[model samples]
Target chain A: MRPFLFSKSSAINQALAKKNGTTQYIAGGTNLVDLMKKHIAEPESLVDITSALPAKIEVTAKGIQIGAMVRNTPLANDAIILAKYPLIAKAVLAGASPQIRNMASTGGNLLQRTRCPYFYDVTTPCNKRKAGSGCSAIPGENRMSAIVGYSDQCIAVHPSDLCVALAALDASVKVQDKSGKTQSIAFTDFHRLPGTTPERDNNLPANALIHSIEINENAFAKNCAYVKVRDRDSYAFALVSVAAALNLKDNQIVEARLASGGVAHKPWRWLEAEQYLKGKTANAATFEAAADIAIKDLRAQSHNGFKIPMLKGAIETALQQCLNR
Target chain B: MKQEYNFSRRFFLKTSSALGALAFIPKGVKAFYEEVKNFIVPKKEQLPLTVSINKKSYAIKADTRTTLLDLLREDLNLTGAKKGCDHGQCGACTVHIDGERALSCLTLAAMVPGKEVTTIEGLANGDKLHPMQEAFIECDGFQCGYCTPGQIMSAVACVKEGHTKSVAEIKEFMSGNLCRCGAYNGIVESIQKVAAK
Candidate 1:
């Protein structure tokens, strides 16, 4: 049964402040409500954080600071962000159907749970739920599972397309606490695994409010863009996705950063591959070597074994496209 | 008790008869019934949300169980927004909050207490329609008009935000608002017209 619920963003923080661990904060209700209907998430006392937080997208000294409350459409069209951070715009555009984007936030996008079939099926014995419980998805139907940085416990891919962009951008998140204290978490370290506790998807405690995602002014800022391969044109998660950024100096690769989504438990970064890419004259061959390194030693579930090559191809193709553009 | 028993018996028979007749009902209706199971089954808890629509304010209570789309159409009598999907998958119930396009279906009524909300009903200058409404009608931007309000709202924002640099740019920006009517030609034309002036 769905939980008896009350929704107040402030009340959510207050309730979290008062309670032990029995409430969930809601934004947009796109993912949470959908899961609730599927009987995947049985949240009691849903604290609606939609109205409580102010939505904004601003240019800061560090870089672009997008409030966690700002919707996808605003971010996708923000003039400075679109021109300065086209990867964010492209990534936001490539996500779930437009209507869902209208409701989904960058913070909620990062905070989005996995889209695993077994995870949603309440009857399934998923390790992401009860630690040490066998993961039905690992063997049963993991065609859409991870291809990199995976563990035995869980292989479900992060569903947010926008998160891949933020990860590539090396975005930092600011979260407000119940006591009104604020703390910042790096984009990559924000999401955790279902390891023994596969249920815990994010590092944010119950009372923490995701305030903003601060994009760092890195060398890859202007050159990055997101590309995905999905079953449908839009609204579906990727079979393989790539967020690639390149900075060329003197016709040689001065810097390159690559991150992949829909193919990992977290936003899988290719730091080794990126290091390999620097000081090389970028071409399809250079991208191929880096992509190969990125997918090296990946643990793929049954259906996802095909994703490694697909991801490599996707990254190479996206890199070439950006270079050409 | 006798009359009550008769009413119960009649009710059961009526239900059975309806079920019998429903054998010819479409598969979609059966699926709809199955999908609506949660809506009918009330959980242990619910909360009150006092909200305002158009310009008038309401102090009514709502189920924490309700979506803003249902809260508006079912309880509040503002049926301007249509429910294409209870999921945020569709932009049928898109409305304006402080002049920005928002999906009402994805929003909960309890969430918007002190904010100003403007639905399709409130998008007129004394029955003379907002420029977007008139432009959409003149350009035939909508076919069914079901997704029109959302399209209009998003289109206005797009132009105001100055995303009409090129057709590709407009398509990319407006990609969030879908018109299954295949009226992209008109939709683009309408936005281009508004954006030009």
Candidate 2:
């Protein structure tokens, strides 16, 4: 790794003012350090923002506000999260190893780059790594590539199980810029599709710091499930995962939210399918139809067509689990 | 043909003139030129750090790019924490930062100034082995023993976190520390033994 200046400060505005395109903010350093060691990322300066960001999980008028620096393990095991947002806890637990969860911060996890093999292998052409460079995954080994919301420029999927649950829960990301101005971005809009600018993963403004994530109270806490299908039962990225939540009244769905992972650049959400499930009886048939609608417009690359059925089954299974609960 | 002696007056005059010109350059411009030169050249940034490790404090100079794992094994000579993958994929570098288990390889040494770091070397109290270490030995929890330190560290944390309810739970919690020798049975038994106590 190249040597660079490292500064630690508790002032957000000062850190943001120092941040440039070549400067990075280090929180947990779980992913950033690894990428730096691989020479995939070479930041000229790194501001240690772990102290700069808030680390508290606070109860708000809205359900809860998770500070950007909250570690994944604490977030997963938080009593409030386990009780009020069980799917979020389950999804966090299902994603990485215990040690990683212990060190990975919430904001860092949201900003983690894709685990696409080409992106890691510097020799390969990865548009996400180098803008305008040809994407090797389109014609090369792409079994783990995106199956939905993929443009010709890139076919990489966001690899956060927590983000999928957040998308389903309609969480909002609050950010602060160098001017100390703050704004909230809906969870679904936080991550971007890999359009012509695959190099840019999220819509977070440059040099802005993520403040916190706000999730509103919902009735689906008791009837929500996060189902992740992967090659292994532990410590692996999802091949296809689903976060399903439903609000039920008299055995009929009052509202539904579904988001999928490992199949899209962003957490794939089907609002139309969710809208279709509303007022419908909660059952396997209805869930199957919803799954079909969710997968109807999804197109797969050459090697990732299997993800279509995997995603459909994952969605159905997750909804069925939610229904059973 | 014979090689000629090349100590020419013209070369000496040119070198002296360049040195004379450099001496006349303004201090600010010279500093700027040095800054540009530093950017073009790769140089290690050495910073003074005071870190607390295993209840002991040490003030040392470390490269800004050095990982906590390297600072432990290479600088501090605490070789108990092994580097398996050095990429956070393998748990051989597991250590405690502020009593919480974390991968030292992923942690920059500069980041742990105010925090306490406990490595495998700190687990045992002088001649007395930690309970988790004793359990591992009693249960034969390792074969090659490369991942033993990390496994013991993770197992200790797992038990303390109240995640050692069953064999499956032990396996799940200890999945980060991979034992390529397939000695998981003994590892799980060791964790269960410690948790049962």
Candidate 3:
């Protein structure tokens, strides 16, 4: 734990520029605080960027453009977001407690890490932490671990409920770099852990700051939602979850964009599942077929073997709700 | 099946507030906090600040490490905002900043210089209590009264934000403030009572 200076910046690029690889920009501090307490994030300098980012939420022609600093409560209550993108609103509301969502930012929520208990306790050997360190969750308490995105190197789950919904919605993340250059990364690639190196969560450099996130206008997404199964009722991470967007034609599934969580290193887009449902009735058989195809490659841990069933049930329920709606 | 941590913290606040006043964690919590503190000893800095609280402007110099909760209780000698958990997980230390209910535990004192702050003490006009505060008392909205200030602050904001439509909406909006006394049924009743007027 090194003692470092704390800097306040209202400019995202300037705050990122202050990063010497040992500094992290504080957005809402919701994720960072837990990591800091667990000794996982030991950055000496914290650049407070909340003041610099405009906390704006507006219905743009493209979709909803949520500022980096916009709190979840307002987003959950935003009349437009609630009406037009109820999935986003529901996802935002599903995260943790009200205190967490209040202090949580749009950018930070998208960047939140997996809640694998092994990932937090520094003593546990984790591939996501020290490269090549064997995954402790392989044989440890991994009931909440990933069943999709399973590989020899890493298999921890993604934590963001909102990100999964955004992934299905094809959301874009706006970023500003130290050089004041701006870029946008689509939600599919916004978070990555193809594991060969698990430490690099996103494609963004340490000197790049997230600005805002834009959820694309997908008619199917407007009718979507994020549903989670967790150990507890409140303030707990997901055990298995699904973010689903579906459009039906004459009571038959015409289009579907389903992404699953608590089952992957990132929001695992069930494209095979969605493709299977094309021109099919959104009944139990169709859902079961998609769920079966979605987890075909999964090889979970001894404790997390249940995730296969949990994630499958989650997708089935989410898709059914979409069909019912 | 996952072990049930089914006990909701919101339910805890709905029923109890004062009688169950103790640290939420086990005895191991002290050691856990100390270990975390060893990792988070922020390099301290100093700054001068002036801010109005409960109608009086408090002029003071503060270390950047001081949180709004610390400033209120330690600096201004206003101990109404209890510090149940300094980590922003609990809403024990809540105050109104420019009419918006905010967590004082997570708020930096230095960032509040220009804001008009209001604590539980300011909710009364002369000898008259604010309608929400009076309703809370009348409905026995609190058990221990420890989370009363934060609950009152959130209740005031709930009405102001027009979250009085349904019990679920009010619960969703007011979820930020945790009441360990579980006096939430009465708390909601109190808010419903004042919102009726």
Candidate 4:
């Protein structure tokens, strides 16, 4: 919470123009402010962009467009999102408490940092915080580290339940650049696999700003659920979570979408398992098989090996609940 | 790349010219420019803040790094909102911003200028206590009462948001407000009593 310059912007171009490597955007201030207070993030200048971005929840023939500044509570309680995309709503509600949901913005949720204990303790060596400093979680306390798509540089997991559902729903993120140019990034490709540069969380450029998220209308609405297994029932990060959506016809699955959280650097979308579930009967056996396939490639650390089976059970339960719904 | 550079340059010129035109306007636009300038630049790390708290407007100067929780307790002497776990984990600093519950500990003071903030101090109307506050007292919702204010604020919001239909829902919605004394039963009862009406 060091003294920093603060500016408010009502224009996107103006905000983006002032943004750079040392300047950070503030919206809701739930995650960013916490990081700043912990000294994990100390930007010299903060450009408040809550007013600069649109806050509308517009529904079109193709899909729904959620503004970046839309608070998590309103997004979760919105009639369109709750009815047409209950998985998204459930995932959002499962993640944080009511007060947090009131202040957390859609775009800020996507950009939230990992909740690794080592990352928060500045005295420890964390590559994500200080590049090339070596990751403490690699050999230290890593019970919550990533189980898949992790490099030696960092093993932290992305702690977001909303992003998992968005990945399963095939959402798209709209971003505007400092030059006033815009581009769309698919939800699956929005977050990056932690490689040499664990410092870079997502594929977004330094000067780019998230505009909105577009989710297409799909048949998974009737049979979808977000199952999160945590240390506690509420107010805790997920130990393993699953966002399952299935299209069932005549007791058989026509299509399926499965993604996992709390186990990877990004939302782990098991495309192979999703493909395997299709054309199979919507039963416990099919779900168990899909869950097995989903965990086959997961490489767990010494302390987090339990997450492998825990994630498998979560996936099975999520699929069963989706079918039952 | 070339087109992007040209566009950015043109945008800068357009904005500067717009500001230049505003400087010549008689009164209204000039005052607007002054407001915009104040918002864009922090004067010596202290900014002018106009916030409405407890239905009272206060024009004050706050540091750019000051959080709403600190501003309330340290500046305004509104100590009803306690600061527990200064981060967003504990909900001891919960307050209502524009009728929605938010963690004041995480909200910066600069962000509440145009919004209405209602803290536990504002819950009681002079001599009459709020329904949720009265219910908390009737049910003995707290043991040590350290987290009572935050719990009461969240409870009121939970009922208004229609999440208090069942015991499980109330527990889930009020999970942020941690009561270390383990008086969860009374807290649930308090919320239930208010929701029943």
**DockQ metric for all predictions:** 0.27, 0.72, 0.16, 0.38
Scored by Cα lDDT, where does model 2 land?
0.92
lDDT of 1 by residue, B1-197 (tens): 44534467779999999999899899999899877975666455555556667888888777766777788889888888888876666677887766667778767666777777888888788878888888898899989888887788778878877879998778866766667888888988899988888
By summed lDDT, the worst window of 10 consecutive residues in model 1 chain A runs over A11-20
Interface RMSD of 4: 2.3
Model 2 chain A: worst 10 consecutive residues (lDDT sum): A2-11
Fill in the DockQ of model 3: 0.16
Docking class of 4: acceptable
Clashes in model 1: which pairs? A97-A235, A194-A198
lDDT (Cα, tens digit) per residue for candidate 3, span B1-197: 87988779987786576445545657788788888986667655566789899879878988755678889999999999988877666677878877777778767676677778899989899998899988988899999888888888888988987889998777866776778778889988998999999
Candidate 1, residues A116-235: lDDT per residue as tens digits?
Answer: 888878788887756677889877988998876667888887888788888888888888887888888998999875566677888986767788889877676556768899876656
lDDT string, candidate 4, A242-317, tens digits: 9999998998999999999998889989999999999999998899999999999889998989999999999999
Q: List A-chain TM-scores for all predictions.
A: 0.93, 0.98, 0.94, 0.98
lDDT (0 to 1) per candidate: 0.78, 0.92, 0.78, 0.92
Error of 3 at A115 (Å): 3.0
Q: Whole-model lDDT, candidate 3?
A: 0.78
The C-alpha stretches of model 2 lying farther than 4 A from their native spots are B1-36
lDDT of 2 by residue, B10-42 (tens): 999999999999999999999998999987976
> Model 2 Cα displacement at B129 (Å)?
1.5
Tell me the interface RMSD of model 3, in angstroms: 3.6
RMSD of 3: 14.4
Top DockQ prediction, candidate number? 2
In the predicted model 2, the residue pairs found to clash are none
